[model samples]
Target: MPTNGGQIKTYAAPEGVAVADAFLIYARSVDSEPWIPVSTYAVDVAEVNTTRNEFDKHPISVASFDMDGPVEVQVKYTLNKVQSAAIRPKSLGIQAVIDGDNTITFSLDRPRDVMLEINHDKWQALHILTNGIDHNALPSDSQETWYFGPGINNGSPYGLVTDGNLFVPSNTMVYLAGGAFVTFKLNFIKVCNSGVRGHGFIYNGPNGGAILIERSENIVVENVTSLGATGFSLTTGEAKGVTISGYRSFSSHGNGDGVDLFCSSDILVENCFLRNSDDTIAIYGHRWDYYGDSSNIVIRNCTLLPDIAHPIHMGTHGNPAKPETISGIHISNIDILDHYENQMWYQGCISLSAGDENLIEDVHIQDVRVERISKGQLVNMRVMKNEMWTTAPGHGIRNVTLKNISLDATNSQIVNPSQILGFDYTRKVENIVFENLNIGGQYIHDGMGKPRWYMVADLVPMFINEHVTNVKFILTK
Candidate 1:
């Protein structure tokens, strides 16, 4: 509980909705300045039980702001008791000073998306989302922008808003001002050069998603805070040249996936904070009407906090008959906060389950830090023919590299051993390499001391199963 505060910027939610009292958060630029209050918005997340469909809502607190420089943050837990508190991803090495019984303070040198948990309770944590200063923010009164002011807005000058759905036309720009709450699904369907940029909140009701980009091109969705989406936070299908940056989402429903890309290409998702019940970022080849080979994607510098599922998943769904290829993916510099999943079929913090005859290839995942995986494995690459989600078996998975990956399961006893398996002799996993892989302060490399009779996988806690060829672990450090 460090009492230091300074000049900083913060945002607030709308007036109609009451602020959450779970945590009292403040921010400042330096220790010598006064503190600025940051409103903690109430967000309902799910405490999911995979054995049943019925879920319970666990309300959490979230605060967001734009950081132009280094900032000091202070948080005071307002609950009755707080035995101990912690912040994650422990890989960040952010040390907190406890100045009081219920207060803690930490300093951030730059913008980061982190969670604060009191009494080691993760379900009711506080999410602090920060982004770089918007240098190209649209003016509030710009003639080219459709600005939605503060408060709940529906059926406006932008035209047809029915049943909490708004279809944005082509070449249009929409902005949600600070404290503005829009419950509509901002649909960018078949539109070109359209974007939604703001610092506001978008809430989805039940069936649909918060923001959808379908059959669209050159679309940009930046700096939008999505709250409590029952489905996905932002889903893109058959889209091209899409850029998703500085986005934040908190979802708690059954299938609350974040930033799902289906049969899309040339996408860049960076500097985003996604905390959901399901896969934080799922990339697939084909699903429903979205049909193509999903390729050329880059997901970097993002923080994925999955309360239920994988942080990075790919190649699950595809066209079996035509046999699509899901390739050209690069994921780097990511911090996976938590991954909790009980189902073995869907239990991997970084999973590549190639189903539906999809040939998954050319993937590079590097510079990642995985912290506190409560129930899932660190990695799972398998060629499967799961009838539940696919029609036929996948072709194979090839040329995948995991470099500079670190996982810290300090006190976790439920972490499953990672696996890499092929469906059969025909569908094999080939040319896989783990370069500079570190687990629990020990590097898993070939040159490390190991029994001569033991296999390479015996050096670590993973299983290099059958039908996997050309797997190597090299020490680069």
Candidate 2:
């Protein structure tokens, strides 16, 4: 119901949509406000999953921005119905069909308050469809993305006897009936030595998507560490007064997003470490299954190590494709040690290419360092570049700044043109200043064909047709 309409739209998820304890919503800044700041930008916003009841568990982590030093915030999940089960993420379907609708909703209380963030990998995941979900009306175009599916082999023999209780090893090979294991497969991460091998933390095959909270508020996630074999976790939904900090998350073999915010607002994440296979952090504008954008988010002083993909990112194509952009998110003072190890699987360090149809504005990435990176190392702005191929009605990436960046890499350049044509086509980068920024070594970015070397020195500051200015870096050789 964004009556002050420009190009964004919001909708509610249907009734009876099943969801767990965690959910996420990601958004990007739109409009040309190079100096206006995210909190002050004028734009459209929305939330997701407005049908089910939400349970705000005390977040395992909590931290505060706006003030110096480490300040603690009490975390809680806004709850509706109490089912003795622990909180978990909801499963989603692949976008292989034209109307492949798969989503959940969370009804909420008016008093819940939560904070927000984004997960770009989830946005990327939301874009392409899986084979099981693939029912496309048109034949494959050469430019179409490859489609996978909700890969799961639930009935396969994947258990073992441990301490008298049945245990599930991560990579237990299972036999599928018709076809092959590839079709009904559940892949596992090959953790070196100290992988997640505990109770309630087994590789639960596949069919996993997300956990959610709806219209939740006044929650805190503090001092929690639940990494490896974990999927989407520690969420606040459509609530105010939220905080997530001093926590650590591990990665699993499949899609694992840490600390998501959906249809929520006024959230903060600080002093945390995220190690997962997908997007470490994320926020959104709104979804058909849910409604709301991440607002007033401050993620600072954290360590992000996505076991598979980007350590930090935001905005999903579904949001912008609906002509709705994620908004008002800030990420700062973080260290990301990327292990881009999943090549045949994952991608990117930080990707901004959610969709070009909506507004992607007021994103501030400052004082960040990538301690280590591989070939397919850093960001992609593909979503904001192309119009015909993607969704979103009218959009641009403005007032986004990447300042005070220092990284230790092999061949990673600070920024580039090939992977991130979005900053090239839509807006002029202003105050996108980078000072005292360092880049080490060089390599090729894996998925989107972007380079991972200190290439920003080459592509940025292009006094050109469009990307005349940018998240520029002023450094010493």
Candidate 3:
């Protein structure tokens, strides 16, 4: 956890958490020193009520280390009182050892950020973040680095509003030093070639979004912790060539999406942590004044916890006047920790609801493992008309694939079946494939018999409507 390129530092818990004395976490890359653990609060499962209290009284350990490639992570905790332990995504295959003195030691090789839990739950766990290459390295001859140290500084080149939001300008490097907690929103409007990076915290005050990248290009946001945005943690509208890595965000308010890409292209969001009340990551077309198709987006190696809505939501908004197409979106290696949505129509661990004359195609969701789904379905794909945002139904959806998705919904109350439906023949969904989809220790295949299709009711296990064509389930084991 090196900050400002200086000595490596370990962060203490923010506040109000009883640190466990029986646990110790450490990590190290090939060239860096061993990293110690930092204490942070994890949302208690019991406190996940209708009130949406994000940060509860429960405490967990978190540690971050930088590495160019792979790294080794170790956790030593008391095991006499614990029953079972496991790491999330389930694909990592880490093992544990029982040491003497009632302590348990586990080691795992992490290519990215991951979670470790005892008793196989999110109540008490460890979040280890592996930060990749530094994107904040600017040439010394470039523009002077605007440093916001620990306080309320108002002398920035970009004007600070009365509400403490910073209006970042173009062609500048803004760095918030370690331990610096700035209570402001970073606004990037119509700017290019800029970045916001640090180990500090950016707290977006009431009634404002945390980071807004609109109509900009070649922007990067890295290694920053943003807290409590009323709108979204990080949002991009009509922007392109944006790279966000190792960014951690937490939001508890309504409509507080993690990373919302609206009518943007060539965006990459990776190695991040997002716990939001709304969709963790949403890609939409044409919202407000931004009107166009969204393409070439990749969201990978991230841990998502949706306290309210879908972990991944797409194609909800589009322009009816011109009909936009959202294509070439790939999401891989994601660990969906929790998804809680009350409305059945808008509930899914992953949802692709194409509306408003939008064509959502060439989307691939692969290698995802859902550890727990409290109240939603596994997958939901539809081409329908939205009563709230669309004047017309979606055009068509084609060439979408879901591969190696395993959901352990053993403790979930999944009343509705996973769906792939179309509004009509003219606006149908076509060429959708499901491979190795495992739910509750059972694989979904043709041998399970033809799927039952339902209209306007709670569905069965796998529901494929009439207008969905060329739907194939290729299962292995």
Best by lDDT: 1
1-477: candidate 2 lDDT, tens digit per residue: 111112211122112212223322211113321211111101111112225432111211111111112111211223322122111111111111111122222211111112221121221121100011112312211222111111221222323322222222232212221111121112222211111110011122133322233454444444323423334644445556566655555445444677766545677888765656567786655644655555678888776755455676566534543455566778887766543543422244555545435556777777776655554545444434334434442255556666566546443433322244444444432334444544553321212233676354453322223453454455533
The full ranking of all candidates by TM-score, starting with the best, is 1, 3, 2
TM-score for each of the candidates: 0.94, 0.48, 0.80
lDDT scores in order = 0.83, 0.39, 0.72
- Summed over model 3, clashes come to 0
Clashes of each: 5, 100, 0
Query: lDDT by residue for model 1 over 355-395, one digit each (tens)?
Result: 99999999999999987788889999999988789999899
Q: Model 3 off-target regions past 4 Å? A: 1-8, 12-83, 96-105, 108-112, 130-144, 149-162, 409-415, 440-443, 447-460, 475-477
Q: Decide which is better by lDDT, 2 or 3.
A: 3
True lDDT of residue 393, candidate 2 = 28
The list of candidate 2 runs beyond 4 A from truth reads: 1-211, 227-230, 318-322, 339-347, 354-356, 385-394, 410-418, 423-431, 441-456, 459-471, 475-477
lDDT of 3: 0.72
Lowest lDDT sum, 10 consecutive residues, model 2, at 37-46
lDDT of model 1, residue 164? 69
* Residues forming the 10-long window of minimal summed lDDT in candidate 1: 1-10
Indicate the worst ten consecutive residues by lDDT in candidate 3.
1-10
